[model samples]
Target chain A: MTVEKLYDAAGFKTISKGDGKKEVKAIFCCDMLSIAMSKAPASGCWITVVSNMNTLAVATLTDVSCVVIAGGVAVGEDMKAKAETEGIALFTCEEPAFETALIVHDLMNA
Target chain B: MSEVKLSYTISGDDFTRAGEASGDVKSKLKVLGVAPDIVRKVSIALYEGEINMVIHAHGGTIDVTISEKEITMVLADHGPGIENVELAMQAGYSTASENVRALGFGAGMGLPNMKKYSDDMNIETRIGEGTTVTMKVFLQ
Candidate 1:
């Protein structure tokens, strides 16, 4: 599945940039649990972590495509720079974590 | 490939560098060319152990051994020994102070998550003494 497919299912109104047709097969959406669960994505997981700099660390380790911050999750500038430098996608949404998880589920399953 | 082993000291006082050990291990696993899933499993388990050491143990040391067939990790902390390992293993059960929680930790998910990710685990601690955790993740 492409990032656009996930965005549409997640009801994400805005996209960061340069996400044309990148593909992902799995998704893990949550906060702090990114420490353990995020890294355990089946394969091709585009994790959605709503934490701060820590999420950046998980993205680097798990080789995620994009990290969608659910419900307008926010992070500091350092985290943003780390994500950019690591070449990981960072996005946000207005829906809550659970809702975002559902959307991610449908997208990955579809 | 040559039975790589790395060790690091985790400082509880410095929340800024909590994940440093995990980061190093992650990169090491990457260099070893481990499968992404295996690397992730090792890194997450070790990362949780690192956080637990930083939070509960005041500070601790982690030793990681990686080979062609397996990854082994040992986290030793002299902070405060857990009184009840069973209760502590429960999800949502955390002894983290409010201060630690404020730093986005102490969620009570550390040990459980570690056990969930690792193929084998052993935790030994004495109340008021210290704690040592050993976990192993096998490569397929």
Candidate 2:
């Protein structure tokens, strides 16, 4: 599904403007930046609770389609700026990471 | 063949800046038209080393050399060196403190991940003196 569709389905608020039309290849759920960087599928959506500039860095390096920060985590301003600069798609939601992951998984499987 | 060299200082506990060097190298390699797999390999290897330097060592210096056939990264640090190189290299062995673990790292996968991605890797360390890691990724 496209990022826009996923955003609506998962009820996420966008922090960075990625190509909303870009198709997501898959969804990866992890808070560890190293493991995410090593294992996340390129062009997939990353679901995590860690809200930091490093989150943006990992997204940029791995070329993820979007980052879904779950659990109502308040991402810092610096991280938002970095995400904007890197042209990475970053979003946040009130739902927990596991719940968001489930929604994304169902969407992908649907 | 001509080569490009880059260097950066990784400050200790500076989690925000940990991946800066590797990101720069990845961008340069992409601009140089290096193969995707090779670029990914070098980026992953170098970033792991950068994280290690930040958490274990009190920061360090990373020097990268990019040639037509290979990319070489040399990371050197002046901190408490590894007490057991063999054990440290094991997949699930880590000495990082709880604080480091909370940052979502210290999972004992740093060195092993670095080795997995690099074509060649070598570690030179002295318990009190320091540690230096050299890794190379071949372009094929």
Candidate 3:
């Protein structure tokens, strides 16, 4: 599915509309950057509670289609700017990472 | 015989810029027509090394050379050297502080992941002196 479609279906708040047309093929949930770095699939939607600059870096490195910041984590202004500059689709939601993953999973499978 | 060489100075004080070097290398490799998997592996390995330099060492320098046959990365740091290379190589081993963990790193997977991605990995360290890591990813 496309990032825009996921945003609409999941009802998550958008932070950066980077490559809204980008296709997402998988769902990965992880907060540990190292694991996420080595394991996150290309073009996957990442669900994580960690909101930091490093998150964007990892997203870029892993080539994730989008990053869904869950658990009500507060994203830094610098991170938001970096996400925009790097063309990384970013979304934020009050739901915990697991709940967000569930929603993404259902949408992806449906 | 033709190759592209890149170097960067990693700053220990800036947690936000840890991956800049790896990201640059990733882009360069992509432009160079390297395979997707090889590019990812090289980026991941170099990124882990960059993070380690920021967290463990005060800072360091990374030199990358991309050639037709392989990509070589040499990371050197002047911070307090690793106490035990063997233990550090174990998965789930990390000496990073709690502050570093809050940033979503310090899980002790940096070195191991570096090794996992590179075709050949070597570490040379001295107590109270520094450490140097050399890694290569072959292009096929």
**Tens-digit per-residue lDDT, A59-78, candidate 3:** 99999999999988878888
lDDT of 1 by residue, A16-72 (tens): 433536676666654554343444353344434345666666655665666777766
True contacts kept of each: 0.24, 0.46, 0.89
lDDT against the true structure, per candidate, is 0.73, 0.86, 0.92
* C-alpha DockQ of every model: 0.29, 0.67, 0.92
* Predicted candidate 1 versus true structure: per-residue lDDT over B1-140, tens digit per residue: 68888989888867666787898888878777888778777877888888788777888999998877889999999977999899999988888887777555667889888998899999999989899999999985
Residues B41-107, candidate 3, lDDT per residue (tens digit)? 9999999999999998988999999888999999999989999999999999999899999999988
Comparing candidate 1 with candidate 2, which one achieves the higher TM-score? 2
B-chain TM-score for every candidate: 0.96, 0.97, 0.97
- Which candidate leads in TM-score? 3
Per-residue lDDT of candidate 2, residues B16-132 (tens digit): 888998899999998898988888888888889998999989899999998888888999999889999889889878888887777677778899999999999999999898999
lDDT of 2 by residue, A43-79 (tens): 8999999888777777877878999999998888888
Q: B100, model 1: CA deviation in Å? A: 3.9
1 or 2, which is superior by DockQ?
Answer: 2
> Considering lDDT, where higher is better, how would the candidates rank from best to worst?
3, 2, 1
Could you tell me the lDDT of residue A40 within candidate 2? 83
